[model samples]
Target: MAAEANADAVLAELEALSARLTEVEAYLHIEEARGRVTELEEASAAPGFWDDAEAARAYMAELAQVKGDVGLVDRAHERLSDARAALELADEMGQDGAEFIAEAAAAAEELTRAIDEMELSSWFTGEFDHGSAILSIKPGQGGLEAQDWTFMLFKMYMKYFARRGWKVTVNDCPAAEVIGIDRATITVEGKDAFGMLRAEAGVHRLVRISPTDAKKRRQTTFAGVEVIPVLPDDIEIEVAPDDIRVDVYHASGPGGQGVNTTDSAVRVTHIPTGIVVTCQNERSQIQNKAACMQILKARLYELELEKRAETLDEIRGPKTEIGFGNQIRSYVLYPYQMVKDLRSGVETSNVDSVLEDGDLDPFIIGYHRWATEQAE
Candidate 1:
């Protein structure tokens, strides 16, 4: 590859990668990030910094992410400069410099990939987009099939979350009386978890031969996927404690001795907003209530954001819902086998790969790419 390597083309690619890296760095405000890092470091070192656990965590996470971005840009710049110098050196030398040219070509490819990832990260500029997320899945229409479909959707997201290396906490997932689950809510903790998952915040439809049907008839089911960024305790919410209600209930599911015996599950309801959150995964009512509060706060924060901005409609559409004809994506298995994202115009015949193994990058990346164009 070295003997036939076009050094000029390789150099051009490296230059473009370098320019893109600079653009990402600028968009991320690396200089401002460095200043913010210094401020955060000083504050963290002061007395009682860790007194508020959630706020300290948020502050530390931001500092770490900013530092990482700055480091990534710094290394990418060095790689670009080195690759350019290698090409120049190869040009000055004779055929003996072919190896250097080949090395620079490889570096160019690597830098391209790294810069592309950085560019994607730069798109998550929202307040909580870079943070973790609260995700909920509820079966819509189709009765028993809908319940089963809810579990399928939950499994698909579990696979997707595993692929993304996000830590997921199943705050609640109660099985239906006969088939799948009544509802499933999870907390996804990872960098850009909310930003990426928000792509799936809408209705998903699945059509297939119903396993619950004795006649093997085809059935269509719908499930709603809600994604909201995890609200940090530092952010003041619009609700008051007086306007909220808390209830405890015995946890329901296939469980152990202490699990189903007592009222360990907690439900939180915001009266004014009519937002309800439930958590039953923990055996302790207090822990479950905490989880419910976390999810509730996220929902409340999302509601507040809705009133102030229009950009959320890009991800969630205009009053999009979980019902017939409102699906953002469709998975067909009976007449034809395919998984399609209506918003991104991305589809594939590999239904098993999507529903089973969780190959979701195409749809997620495609949605962002499409959204970027619509914005432009």
Candidate 2:
């Protein structure tokens, strides 16, 4: 009876904590500032709204008030998450229900102290992070080896996502002749998928022996990874049919072997932006067309988001630091094995493990902390 009562108490506490956590997550995910901004907008729609000095003052004042409320909610959410994490850890480790309560109490207290030491960092908390992501990997310099390295990277990420139990779907795989990949895009679907992959948006550099060379010399290669948020259907994007040029082609394998007898591949090019998206993964031409259009919309949406940034300096620009010229992270297999994230300056000398299995939590947390510092 005592044990049952203890279990009930713990569950009750957890239920309350979960409710608070959900509230915080909602506030963090959506800009609550939108409400106040909307009010200001509605006020402007009123007759002589802009010209009325008293009305303008009142609207601006209300906007500021809502902004403050939103910030408070965001902070509360971060604290709630930390508390819940501590409680979860304790619950997993405790022997019995009563012990779980005692352990959780201590853990929660410790978390309170830890969180008090610093401000919360959570820049990756956008509506996009809640959805899946599209990761595009393309090889940079170096010869046939570079292409081979890109293929290796493609496999590495696939293995990583597989280990995490995340669903991965390859949309396109443009293969190289001898031994490499020209370009490839993969969709990783899971909870907080974009947040997990946000750190991988930069360049990746690899240094190793060239198997193709008669002389096994050390070679350096680069690959660029572009991570884009997969927008949902609710997020409306207005694109006119006349603005796009759609092409149909028979899909083929690496060596031009016709995989589909019919023209099942669809390529959609945004005429205005010159953004081209191709999809041949689906067996049906109609499905491929839909897939291509989905990617096209995502890319265009990302472009617009970037454009809205305050200045050109805020943008990642043309070059991705992920590769030969620049690198946000590196995986070394020869001479020494190590994995490092340049932005966070975090590293682990377990290249084999990281490549074989994707354990990116450390890197992601580091990047999140770093992003928070930048904002401060």
Candidate 3:
């Protein structure tokens, strides 16, 4: 009787998982993804398809994604079937059903994890969700404390990217006088980098004992994080020469010595919007100008997204403000250690692990689900 009861429980759990898998399949439009995979496969096999290197690479990447999306459901079904078979075989040997029940439980847990990941992927429906991201962190209030906070954020993100197996390139980092960084820009490249990091935008508040203060008082500091998607090569953003000012100067190092002999540093200002972008990391003037233009385009794209969000807000209601004075997350390290996300109500007392060890998935997942719910 005991063996039978365990088997029944395992079967019931497997049944529920099957139902959830069905829902996931429907939500993911598995049939549509399969069709896309077929189309991409046919295109990839066509003659001269590889002639256009960029287009060929994009097609192959899309094909892989579609196949993987479809495979998730397929694999889950296979696991369910295997679990059922194992349970049936164990039932024949009634005395040893517990071992098989354990296997079934493990399989069920795996399926649940896969389903959760699929659900998260479903929330990435934004236009530029799958692209690389350009992220910037700037100090706000609290003087040098804010600068130190900004640098901490920069390191946290770098660690987070490393954990994700993403590549990060520091585009620009200017150190502060006493400690930490004044401003930093980084490029994170990986699958769905922009989609995940976009949730990290806005102000981040930090409350901690000031190391720079003599009295050892708790200080509240603010740092702004901006994440923008790197536009694909196929998308063209037009910026007229008449509407921009271009400045060229020699690139300088930390000690104010000229890093390059020529005037390689380029600063481009969008006259109408008064947005300024500079690129001095590259060696040649042409390269710096190109990099500056790319950053400018990304900024413009972000502005357009904001405008669209505002229009949508007019229809729905007022949403959280995007810029200064609107902090999304707060890290407290003074009396108590806690990291909390204001919008998602997700908080964890493991502040040190979050800041030092780069445990950010919980907050990211919470915010993603919250945003998805709001969108729906």
Error (Å) of candidate 3 at residue 352 is 2.8
| Each model's lDDT | 0.84, 0.69, 0.82
lDDT of 2 by residue, 224-257 (tens): 8888878876687888999998888877654445
Which is superior by lDDT, 1 or 2?
Answer: 1
Better of 1 and 2 by TM-score: 1
State the local distance difference test value for candidate 2: 0.69
**Could you give candidate 3's per-residue lDDT for residues 1-376 as a string of tens digits?**
8878878888898898889888888888999998999899999999999999988998998898889889888998899998898898888878877788788878887877777777777878778787798898888888888888988998898889998899886666656677787688788888789888887877899989999989999998988887788899878889999988999986664324456788887889999999988777788888877887888998787677668775322111233443356788999998999999999999999987899988898898888889889878
Query: CA shift at 203, candidate 2, in angstroms?
Result: 0.9
Better of 2 and 3 by TM-score: 3
lDDT value, residue 297 of candidate 2 = 85
Candidate 1 lDDT over 20-101, as tens digits, reads 8878888889889889989989999999999998889988987898789888888888889889889888888867778888
Q: What is the lDDT of candidate 3?
A: 0.82
Regions of model 1 farther than 4 Å from truth: 1-19, 30-59, 74-113, 238-242, 254-259, 305-315
Task: Give the Å shift of residue 208 in candidate 2.
Answer: 0.4
